[model samples]
Target: MSVDNRRVDASPSPAAPPPPDPGAAYAPGPARPPGPASRLRRFATPVGILAGVVGAFGYVATFDPNEPGHYPVCPLLGLTGVYCPGCGGLRSAYAFAHGDIGTAFGANAVAVVGYFLFAAVWVLWMVRAGRGKPLRIGLAPVYWWGIGALLLIFSVVRNLPFGSALAP
Candidate 1:
């Protein structure tokens, strides 16, 4: 009996694709133009957000947060006498709704800034939706940290004597 010395290949066929590159960025394929219904659907989220904000502002405007029993006091302020970042935000909103921008800022400067920031972002979102593009706010970690630091500073300052101007 003669012994055969030929080896058989068990590896994948040469036609098979190579593994994808993990570091490669994803590129979307060509997109079709949005129709009327598609445009309406895209705009829905921003519109809904606007409606909710308007409703909330309307309610705050109607009920004065400065008056007792109108709105609940901030638990942190009520308990420990420390003003959180959100303290007096309701009064700020209420003043803003009534077109009292100066009073609104006096109530909570941070909240006023946030309100304007939200409005700007909402406008951008609407514009992107109209153009059939997704609104992507890809803020870096540094930006998030900066925002946290700002809120912390605001909260700390508002509670101090020097920051009495910032307090409600």
Candidate 2:
């Protein structure tokens, strides 16, 4: 032959796969049905979180935040004499735990609203976990910004004389 110009392909064909072993006795099947233990396992995280929250509320309820030298003062309030959104959060929690709803709102209306929001979210999380679905709180950036603006407004209002009722 004068010249050989043909190119040879090196790659394996896509349709080809390694042959299965005939000697194997067992093959993987579909997933097994969830048992009582499995269902309980799914709820472990939500229950643990609830336990932690309950413990924290219990501690706050036991040790009054309104009393002097009980809890740490908010650094922003201590330094600038200006209230932050979370300034009275502990006190609010204490009041809420004690079933003093009005006092809780008086301490921090935003914090009281936040407590209820957290409870709602926690319930949703628990329900989704029970259903084997992931909890999705996909808030838009605008919503987050709006929340921040609201907190800023709350902080500013609580500091003003007219909004003194919002202060702790």
The number of the candidate with the highest lDDT is 1
- Segments of candidate 2 deviating more than 4 angstroms: 1-37
lDDT of 1: 0.92
Clashing pairs in 1: none
Please give, for residues 42-65, the per-residue lDDT of candidate 1 as tens digits.
999999999999999999999999
Per-model C-alpha lDDT, please? 0.92, 0.90
Residue lDDT tens for model 2, 61-144: 999987899988889888988899998899899999999999999999998998899899999999998888878999999999
TM-score of each: 0.78, 0.77
Q: Which candidate is the best by TM-score?
A: 1
Per-model tally of clashing residue pairs:
0, 0
- Error in Å for residue 10 of model 2: 20
Report the alpha-carbon TM-score of model 2 versus the true structure.
0.77
